[model samples]
Target: MSIELKHLRYADAAIQHGSFRKAADALGLKQSNLSRGIRTLEERLGYRLFERSNGGVQPTLAGRDFLQSARRILSDLQTIVGAANAVARGTAGRLRLGFYTSLSAGNLRNTLCDYARRFPDVHISALEDARSRLFADLRSGALDIAIVTGEPGAEFGTSMALWSERILIALPDSHSLAAKDALTWADLKRERFVLSLRDPGPEIEAILIAKLVTPGESLDVDHHDVSAESLKSLVSAGRGITVVCESCMGSVPSGMVFREARDGNGSTRVGFCAYWMPANENAALRNFVQMLEERCPPLQP
Candidate 1:
């Protein structure tokens, strides 16, 4: 005969009340049924559990040990059930996230904070890397989602437009352009630019070419093997101006300032998108994607 959860539960209740009648009333069972369950449990273990007394019932020395073990078993089973329920509800699990943008400040940073607060049980593993690698990781199942600059195209996976941030020009405090309230793309044409030799650096170079590149003239831009922040540091030292997204404005190095880069329409803004595998079935990923959709809905045509 196998000992079941109900049998252990019955034994524990009887021990707690020290009476079959009281335990049966507490468990909403008939006294005779409670007594028989206890008797069957004792038979399974080949030992007497409770001794009938004038007080109603009391545990034998062997019954005391069985009750103690039964209580522990019940506690562990409760923990297991709770954890499984949390996973089933998508509230508890691991989320592997990939992003290339700086979270110094902006929508990306705010979204992360909101997600953490809303789903405390989700263990978020945030990985910062280049765009190509983020896509590679997503395809390999190493990442659940990736947020990056520009439309991630159809080949990466499913993509959604999430948010957009202004493209700002970083200039030295003493630069003449600092005196202006804002700057136009034409204003940046004659200026020397210092850019990173990284993922966004290439993107920035492309923008500079499209916006400020004059026919039959080369752009005076220096490519530095450094991070975006380091590129800003170069601008702070008056080496040359650089461009960064508005989100990066939070941590601009001292002596440097940011100006909104504008075109004929308005501020030059970079759009960001989220990418994930079409076949990814991670519940945690689904929850995060849903949160993004609610916070940053698709723009109207």
Candidate 2:
């Protein structure tokens, strides 16, 4: 037999009040209507739910067991309704954010914290990856939105550039260059450098080769989630100095100091850009993109 929520609610109310008249009054239904509804429910279930008594009514054994189940069903229904409303209002849902290694500790961290404070119901998950992997994920639907460094000739569905900062030289506190207020690319011509293998894309490698002297030997680190943190540790131990985005200075090891590269103007600047599939735009994702644009204006592409 088909059971409806209305039937369950009426049964729960009747059992709670323990009388047809009281149940009807509470439910804003006439006593006769309430009586007939209960009678129909019992008939459909093929059992007598209540036993008529001299005082009024009492639940039968079957009725007693069914009352708890009925109440539980009604409670569950109410919870489902509440959750549905919350989702419909865009006040609750999950957001997956993809970010490159560099931004994870700087602007992205701050932006996510602010978003969480304002919308506590929204669940946010951050995934850190290299720029190439992040771009692939964004195109394949693996990421909702991603923060990546912009490429000059690459095509994207939709994107907004967030921040642009000149690359700075990270040197150990004891390094000779640390005493200098600022550095030029030529200043590091003879220094051993700790470089991430992933830092040199076709475009960036050309720039780096043009500026710094080829090191006799170097540490080739895998560029991943913990790569930057590990690189900072190496610099702190006085292993070598590396060039990184100026924003990364805030997160580098305590003993490390960052200096602006004097020739940084024409150098590759790190930028944060958000990209998503153009055809898959939803209200929440759209709002998030709009928020990024408002917070950080895009550079001319």
Candidate 3:
């Protein structure tokens, strides 16, 4: 006696229409077939589900209980199907974007706005953290995609250098270096420097240390958001100078000046790269990567 969905469906229709003839019409089935299905269902359950009357039909206690469960099962099944369809269409899913401090301004913000406008149903979220944390989040599936500063030897499922811009030196407007169009690394040899401490990759720090007399005199600020603000304040107060990506100049506080670093190979550029898990195949993530490449072409390695 295998239970079937058609049996439950027939039972529900029969109860709704109050007679087998009417239920058959509603279901587009012959009256005899409908009556047989109801009879088989009642027999399998060892109970009389309905009381036949000349005027109408009424459900017995068992039929009433069965109808409740049948409706719930049907509703749940419909929901599952709808969710599957939504995912297939690239809508109604969550996307976690990993972004580093430097990109919060120009490229990252523009890309996010475009993605949101095009896919309004997708749930988009951002995790603003350092490079190392962003990579960790991607590896753990906490993030679907990350925009990080380039790391040469790090393991990644897929990565591309999105863009690069020269590093700039921020100084007080009254500082001696402010008179120059650009200041070389040598110009800041004796100047105090402020930098973000978290994951400033050894390669970049080593470059700065090689040019400065006392690289340890550099201040370790928490994150870029804080570091940038604090650096501007320190510069305004004539406490120190800092080196930052040119993009940071847009938000620099008043009384501070920004100039390209002299030793900066016009290409002493910071790289923006994207990373994702190779094995975790997701349509939304793939589409996002494509969008990034389309919006901002990658720089040649």
State how far residue 224 of model 2 sits from its true place (Å): 11
lDDT of 3: 0.73
Error of 1 at 40 (Å): 3.2
Question: 139 in model 3: Cα distance from truth in Å?
Answer: 3.5
Worst 10 residues of 2 by lDDT: 217-226
Per-residue lDDT tens digits for candidate 2, residues 8-75, read: 77778878888878888999989888788888889989999999775767889999998888888888
Model 1 per-residue lDDT tens digits across residues 1-301: 6887898988899888989999999999999999899889999999988999978788899888878888999999999999988877779988999986678999998998999999999999999888889888998999999998886478757999888999999999999999998999988878999988876788888898999877898889898988887888899999999989887977978899999998889988888889999898888888999999999877789
Question: How far in Å is the alpha carbon of 145 misplaced in model 1?
Answer: 1.0
Number of the top TM-score candidate? 1
Task: Please estimate how well model 1 matches the true structure, expressed as its whole-model Cα lDDT.
Answer: 0.89
Ordered by lDDT, highest first, the candidates read 1, 3, 2
Candidate 2 lDDT (Cα, 0 to 1): 0.71
lDDT of each: 0.89, 0.71, 0.73
User: What are the per-residue Cα lDDT tens digits for candidate 3 across 1-301?
Assistant: 7777788888888888898889899999998898889889889889988988888689988788977788889778889989877777666677888765454356666788888887787888887777778878888888898876665335867777676667778888998889999777777766766655544434355557755646356523222335455666766777677777655655777788888886645536676677888776666777788888897775558
